[model samples]
Target: MEEKMIVLVAFDGSKAANEALSLAVKHAEAFKGKVVLVRSLKGGADIDSEDIQTAEQDLAYAEQFCRERSVPFETHLLVRGCSPGEDIVRFAEECRADEIIMGVRRRSRVSKMVFGSNARHVILEAHCPVVTVK
Candidate 1:
């Protein structure tokens, strides 16, 4: 029997994230694997009703996306006092994921030099293989 793969998809409600979601669904379907969609809320972000509602919407959209594709998946929202990249890596470890899929915004040299990339951080820290979608 083939090994059952656990895929962790990191979402931030960006177009790149949506692309990662799409790829994750395809991969999961092909491998007959299970997908865990995670949305992280960084610390210091406001937690008003509107913000909570927006987070719910993001998870809903991800769930809908997988449903439309007939992908077997689960959804989770991680709201801890950590950076997005850190949260993703930690969650993947906790879930014992075989792979992680996340969106990456291509940054210019100046931007990358000034501000570190979340995708880079996760890639460096994750124990599992990471797939970054632009």
Candidate 2:
């Protein structure tokens, strides 16, 4: 509580992601810290122009929310060629984040395995504590 908290939020424009953002903002506001919102894309064939546009829109929306709440924030659109989980984990370490906030969608075990759960990967790989929002 003595030091400013650096809260990293994984945002993807979903309801769950929005919930995570809200939580991050509350934490930052209470601690007089900062919030870092990150959206990850693998680029290339994995993502299209529409995806890029949506990411921008989502980032803008989150930015507006933070501005309205007077919460200090940063927005990062990461296009590194890796899984979202890896990007998030690496980014957190790079920024030396105090905590990570993200959302977990209910998925069948098979689906998670096929799609690769970013939350699971992040929980296992991140150096910082991760808080998940439904």
Candidate 3:
């Protein structure tokens, strides 16, 4: 039997992330693929239990959304004090994803260079094709 095509999406409950999630669902429908939702927390001394709880809620919402669309999906949380971009790319690689979908916000080139953009990093580092939704 053929292996299932996987579409990985980076989500954080922001508008852009939600947009990415929606697009991933559409893409999954088009390709008969499964969706994987990933949420990354920049681990730090400031991160508290409440933060993890909130992240879990966001993932739950994402799961419900996929279920409403009748799309098969799994959610993952990455919190190893790593950059979101790195975590996202690592998860995609581990899953052997066929494609990655992420949300990006407009940023000046200089600002992006100074304060790295996760979307940009994922685009550069992912092993598969990446789709960005603003």
Candidate 4:
């Protein structure tokens, strides 16, 4: 039998992220693969205890979503002092994921210039194929 493909999905509780998560779950069910939900905390932010608690809540939601769908899912919370995009790429590499599903925000040129796009960076840097949900 062929090796089941491993899929890594980045979930940030955004609408696009939720869509990507749904798509990843559907694809995993169809392909008989495993799904890894990765949530990364960016550096330099003074995160309070409440913030961590909120993150845990989000992770729980992701887990529940997978359980409801009966899809194999794992949750990974990465606390590296690095950009979220870079961390996601590294995690994908470490997991040997066949594909990555992430969300992309529609941004104007001015916004893109002022705030760099994480989705863009991930698309450029990731070794595995990326599916971005807008």
lDDT of 2 by residue, 6-34 (tens): 99999999999999999999999988999
| Candidate 4 local distance difference test against the native | 0.89
The best candidate in terms of TM-score: 2
- In order, the Cα lDDT scores of the candidates are 0.88, 0.95, 0.93, 0.89
The full ranking of all candidates by lDDT, starting with the best, is 2, 3, 4, 1
RMSD of each: 1.9, 1.8, 1.3, 1.5
**Among all candidates shown, the one with the greatest lDDT:** 2
Sorted by TM-score, highest first, which candidate order results? 2, 3, 4, 1
Itemize residue pairs with steric clashes in candidate 1. none
Q: What's the lDDT for residue 67 in model 3?
A: 100
Residue 129 displacement in candidate 4 (angstroms): 0.6
Per-residue lDDT tens digits for candidate 3, residues 52-88, read 9999999999999999999999999889788999999
lDDT by residue (1-134, candidate 4, tens digit) is: 78888889998888898999999998899899989999888745685666567777888898999999999989998888898889999999999999999988898999999988889889999999999997
Instruction: Write down the worst ten-residue block by lDDT for model 3.
Output: 1-10
Per-model TM against the reference = 0.90, 0.94, 0.93, 0.93
Tens-digit per-residue lDDT, 1-134, candidate 1: 77668889998788999999988888898899978999887746465667667877998999998888888889888889788889999999998999999999878999988987879889999999999998
Which structure is stronger by TM-score: 2 or 4? 2
Model 3, position 92, has a per-residue lDDT of 94
Give the CA lDDT, 0 to 100, for residue 125 in model 1.
Answer: 99
